[model samples]
Target: MADTTGTVEASQPGRYSVPGPPPRPRSQLVGTGFAIAAGAMAVAGALGHYMARRHASGIDPGHDWLAGQSVPNPQLVYALITLLVSVVTAHWAVWASGRGERGHTWVGMALTLVMGLAFFNMVMFSLNRMEFEIGSGEWATLAFAVTGLSLAILIVGMFYLGLMTLRSLGGSVGRDRSTPLGAAVFFWDFAVLAWAATWYVVYVVK
Candidate 1:
């Protein structure tokens, strides 16, 4: 009977064995990723068209692109800085949620929300103070269109963040339930990047 006891125990149906690692939690992250990619492509296309128009119509001698329209550079700079800070807060929220730090997560989300609102206000102020009307000319129209698209995207991201924040309040944002928070952060970060590009092209390049 060479190792009969070991063979008998191994053959038992209910005998215990070393457990493997826990299964990874399922999430909607993949779907969110696809959506973010599509939104980014749309923004890129709009920016590309705007740049092409600027080069063709604004660059030639005696053909001013802005047509003497004044862009509020100071306000735009503030808005970009606000958005960059929001990026940090948004990531902070995700990080805290992953570690089950509910208080820190709430603080991070709240700060990000406040920064986002401030940025929106600054953008609106800049637009209101601008001398050029949206219907002024081709250049004016394209510029407004690009900036307006960025605002719309930012609004969507804010909406996502709001919903996730509400979910967090209901105790749905811990280590095992952080997927929604992560998705919101991803979209908000995308919004920030889109606005950064828009700021660079429309404000800096002009």
Candidate 2:
């Protein structure tokens, strides 16, 4: 009756049939990071979208346009989506951790993907493609390069993780499957560190 494990043992009320090492209890840091990411995005996305909407003198109100422009700015919406997805992944990680093992690869992959899209597509691309342009500034150029690199890394990391997940999937089900998922999630999480640090240097602080 667990999300990661689809079965429960009748003999042991709190026991599951999933095989594996005792689930690695996540540190507070992991949970806190996930919560912060989600909450910050929700609040920030709402505020950003609202501001863009109100400040746009020419934006269309009919289709959620911010500046009366024909094109709709789904930037804020995208941020919100990433935040929500991250929240869900964090919850799954916690649940599986509670059960004494990491959850499925689906959960880990989902986390990697959510973070990638948000950190790369939403935050990085938004800054480069929207906030700044090719002729904007020296700093802008640097930002573009760094974000581009992060996105590149994200793509490669996803592919590697995908392969790892495939190998794990070829094995028996249950606890057997959690390790690759955990490893992928862990590696992808490391990608976040690379991404944030790199982008921060190029864009935020430079």
Candidate 3:
């Protein structure tokens, strides 16, 4: 009975120690990588088909592949530039998140969102300027298909970005919890690259 409580506490220190939360899963990043690879292959295949069709049409000295439908080159260039800037801001968000710079992270996310919207608006404006009629010819249909696919990808990327931003604001993203933001950034970068490829094939090439 002599100091029994003191003896028991001394013999079981681990019994009173609290355990920390489990490590977050890495599946999100891995799944995103697979998605990006699949998307890249799909886009490459579509672009290759477009090139084949163009080549089949025969590019003689005076033959125009577009059949006189003028592409808005200036607007397309500005859209690409906007996307490139968004890529920087997206990466900045991830970088700041990893360093625990919450303020910088928020700014980066906000800027990236704005840039993404700007790119979308520019693309829409360019499409309007082109006055494309899907029923006009095979070229028109192919052009619309390619651009539509790229825009769809961009929309998905922007949606993911918004979700990640919400999570970050809720304090779910931080130094040790930046994987979600990183995944979003990766997807956004892919979206930008997809659009660039679309621009080169659909605008710059012909």
Candidate 4:
């Protein structure tokens, strides 16, 4: 034993260390929202294609043609305005959220204020023009049914989010940072779901 080498190995157990910065950049509203919206739209689009083909024989040309009547409808003006404002707000929110500036609070507040008005206007216009009665027992009925239900959901959800966003901005003055980005993501997801459902009905049932 004395002749053997006296060197001994350090026998310490490996220890786990606390995580530091994230492996990747933190995700913002736009990043995740885009993915979600895109996915929903894709699903809707595929379903819509299938429905359109299947219901082609059943779809009444007279009924389907009515959609053309509203082509370039005056409602487009309001819809465009809403789209533009939302786009701007979305861009700003994404930028601000990415930058982590507390000032995005003000941007979110402004967006919520203006978007609420646009949302109300659109809802009024849609409600005024949209009317449907029960159709013959067929794909027509199914399409109409789905579209109507989807529209109802969209109308309620959109307005609700608008109110929530506005409240987050305007409920008393303080430096409390609001999760406007999260609201925006939620709103977009709602919209995508509505569009998918509505257009799917139209495409397949038509």
Query: Which candidate comes out best when scored by TM-score?
Result: 3
Name the runs in model 1 displaced over 4 angstroms.
1-27, 58-63
lDDT of 2 by residue, 1-206 (tens): 64785575467754666676885565533654564455345434533443444345244433332222232235534644564455456446534633544245346545745565554556644554464565454334444555555555556556655665565446523453455445445545544445555543433323
Question: By descending lDDT, how would the candidates be arranged?
Answer: 3, 1, 4, 2
Task: State the lDDT at 179 in candidate 3.
Answer: 93
lDDT of each: 0.86, 0.48, 0.88, 0.51
| Full candidate order by TM-score, most accurate first | 3, 1, 4, 2
Lowest summed lDDT window (length 10), candidate 4:
171-180
Error of 4 at 96 (Å): 1.7
After superposing candidate 4, which stretches have Cα over 4 Å from the reference? 1-72, 109-113, 134-206
Best by lDDT: 3
Q: How well does each candidate superpose onto the true structure, as a TM-score? A: 0.86, 0.43, 0.88, 0.48
Model 2 pairs in collision: 1-7, 19-175, 23-100, 23-101, 58-67, 58-68, 59-67, 59-68, 60-68
Cα deviation at 178, candidate 1, in Å, is 1.1
CA error at residue 180 for candidate 1, angstroms: 1.2
Cα deviation of 150 in candidate 1 (Å)?
0.6
Where does candidate 3 stray beyond 4 Å? 1-22
Q: In terms of TM-score, how similar is model 2 to the real structure?
A: 0.43
lDDT of 1 by residue, 104-193 (tens): 999999999999999999988888888677687887798889999999999999999999999998998778789989988888888889
